[model samples]
Target: MNRCLISAAMAVFFFFLAWAVSLRQALLFLVGIGLGGVLAGARFGFTTGWRLLIENRDASGVMAQLFLLGLAAAVCMPLLAAFPGELGAALGPPSYSLLIGAFVFGLAMQVADGCGSGTLYKAGLGIPLNMGILPIFALGSFLGSAQLEQWLQLGSIAPVGLVARFGLLEAFGITLLGLIALGWAALRWSDRIAPWFNKKLFIGAMLLAVLAALNLIIAGQPWGIVYGFGLWGAKAATALGVFDPTANAFWSEPVNVRTLSQSVFLDVTSITNIGILAGALWIAAKRKVGAAEPRSLTGTQWVVGIAAGFLLGYSSRLAFGCNIGAMVSGISTGSLHGWIWVPMAFMGSLIGVRVRRRFNF
Candidate 1:
């Protein structure tokens, strides 16, 4: 896979999307490629970032994340406000499901060693553990979505949109302030001598923020990861005659039903996800020889890691999104559930990191 071959293949795929799907989907695929490239090239690992913060008191990764959040909010909030009719935000209810889901997702991600996007990019990079976990993650996501209505029935509240409730300026201000406060807290908790910034990470955050804004603009929705995984699982189950979309509350919706019948390339998230994979593959192909070999795991470690991947998928649906869907898109778009998702997931990560350590992962 030379760069020329990768570029040609991507171009051919883009033409297929434009011809068979729509130009918008084609462009989104490109955006997804950019996302994959940046994520893999920059080594942007949300799960690893949190783990580093917890285990090493390192703030560099966390701070880079905060920068990403803030930058994305700066761009996305305004677009959401201006195009309220055309664009939609990532909004999820504040529910018992969220509390439980986010916590478990955080914990599971730590053990699995990847969140939604992290898993995707790493899988694209041909990491054996993540590649193995991908299907299990999809299965868990489908199961979680199938049972989501029941989870909400336990207890939930209406989703709150800061932009809608507080107006654009106020919502944006609050988002930035919250990020700044988090950055301060991360700094305080970090090792005194630990570096606060890395040039590569900063550039990565900037590029990702811009790319996320592009996704929102082109797709008429914020960037997401897990929904696509769940959808893939649902499609597989339906093909196997093991699942009924009409019976499941989440999958029974008009839109969901329509999406199920259509080609996955027509689905916004799926196309982007595919693009991310392609982009990552491109990066992997171009890498120099002698890249570090993946670590080998014991049988028990393999079981735990794979099982954790399942939990990651299931919990992401319950949580309304993973780090990308919930935290980045949620907070950037002014959804309060995103705000609620953070601390709960962080608490889960606190426990997850310990479990990871216990297993010596």
Candidate 2:
């Protein structure tokens, strides 16, 4: 009963907020709420899912992600081509910043135990540590964004879109084949069938792909996570008079300037972010939510987790995304940067696991 009331209140609050902004904003918020529910109820998580494969060589979670990526790509790339500027892909410059940023993000997530979307939902579920991690993550995001322009100047290339370069047909085929190969690699490595597939989880991933596609269709761009967090932190800092957006290169960009001045709810990523957290909370209050088992950690572990959360935000800005935004949406949009992000992040994951073990974490 209490859960229902809380959910109702959140819904009302977001509705009014979104409505006050625009109907489109409201719709995006609704999609975000749906995303949160899907994430919580099905327990769809990119961070722990990747960790499972990394630590145990369990490929089930990775396989589902691949499927989701492939399906999203099939639907999204063509739409981007047809609509051109109206429908944007999650493209990023191929730069040293992306390489280093993604690698560090991977390591941080392993220690922090959540990626962008994962952290949002977990925090929404009221996990005490995750809740604590949220603000620190926001702070790191603000700092990272503040310096991002300087990093890009070091060495960067224009953003590439596979559909634009290869055409929709070719891009789709290549993307599908790549996903199939990735899925097969995951399958072959597992050496068993029993754990290879779960009908419910597989279906859940497929549905997730659909929702992701819907996000692109409605918002005219792919779903993003870290950008919203960064925006929030920037806004808070500005409000506190600790920072001046007018001087920050990244914030001073024409598009960003407008977004910062406007209500946060008008921001596509922010609206969805709010929905995911609220939806996750509603689900946790109603039924068993999807999450790994909890365990007690040492004081060292807690400190590491908190620090890692900060890194997760900072590194994600440098890297262009977390697991969902980079590995998932990045690949789905057929950006070469997405491909680059994965292998580097995976390498970080390997190192992260060993470091974690030393702490017995």
Candidate 3:
């Protein structure tokens, strides 16, 4: 089918998904975000470079991320103004600890070859090992959050928005426009950088930002990812007698809190993550690349990657998102943790890459 037809179909599916899922439920939201990601890949003809993170091919992800991040920030400003006490309690003061945590998460992404959300998309497309890793990630996140609560406690930072003094549209518009301009100017200055400046990324980012903002306006919350997966995972584990009650308190009941947990999981965007997976699969099938092929990796690589995923997942829970949810999504919302996590995660990623190389991963 043509892009127009595909886009229209996806739009309808995602809208329905948003309405169908409940607050404090994120499976649907993750689906929606994943759909957004697939839409991004589709717009680019499922290029391997883009799909698998080749040189500058993945710049689309960066652009989309910047736009989304900015929009998130704009929305957050006014949110805090309207609910300072509440926001303060959940976010805490952004600190060095968050930075360290973020670095560790980033490192894990490198080792895993995908961030939390990225892994989900690949997993949904029948990447068997990703299937295994996803659950391990959940367990890790649960354990990490439970164990590192105290050390990471000092980094709670509340969100600040340019919107409280302004308005959502106004703030979002300014931020979005600024980013667009920056992207444009960056591309304009260097022809070599031209290849990295993807129009698809820009379009997808803006479109998703608008969609996300609208969802928030109507649904009474911004977009989020981890809670839905965490809750679902926790519930499943609890059912299986594998999860510990004391350690699993937050994981088992992420929705009960009056924080972003409820909003992230329960919001309309939950379906976005799911849709991303489906959309990626749809593109894969159309391109005749739909077969689920096993990725060949050393046994040692798998063990290390999966083990690292546990750390990554747990850190994400403690810090509020994996790469996409925390670093990308969290920072975009101006949560402060986003910036802190980026560098720290990069450090961990450097180590992770070396580890992968040592294991021939």
Candidate 1 per-residue C-alpha lDDT over 8-64 given as tens digits, one digit per residue, 9 for 90 to 100:
999999999999889999999999999999999999999999999998999999999
Write candidate 2's Cα lDDT for 57-162 as tens digits: 7888888788789888888888888899798889888898899999988888887777888888988877777887888898898899999988998899997778
Candidate 1 Cα misplacement greater than 4 A, ranges: none
- Report RMSD (Å) for each prediction in the order shown: 0.9, 2.2, 6.4
Q: Which stretches of candidate 2 lie over 4 Å from their true place?
A: 287-293
Highest-scoring model, TM-score: 1
Q: CA lDDT of each candidate? A: 0.95, 0.84, 0.55
Q: Name the better of 1 and 3 by lDDT.
A: 1
**Cα TM-score of candidate 2:** 0.94
Query: Which candidate number has the best lDDT?
Result: 1
- Tens digits of per-residue lDDT for model 3, 1-361: 3546766766665465446654323344444644545444534221122222323324454455565557555655556456644442123236545666666776666667666656666665556566678788767765655555475556554554434435556655665665677456434433443456466666665666565544444445445555555555555565688766555444434443333234333434344555565666555445444654666877777798788767667767665666655554554444445545555665576576666567765
Identify the superior model by TM-score, candidate 2 or candidate 3. 2
In candidate 1, how many Å is residue 215 off?
0.5
Model 2 C-alpha lDDT versus the unseen true structure: 0.84
Higher-ranked by TM-score: 1 or 2: 1
Better of 1 and 2 by lDDT: 1
All candidates in order of lDDT, best leading: 1, 2, 3
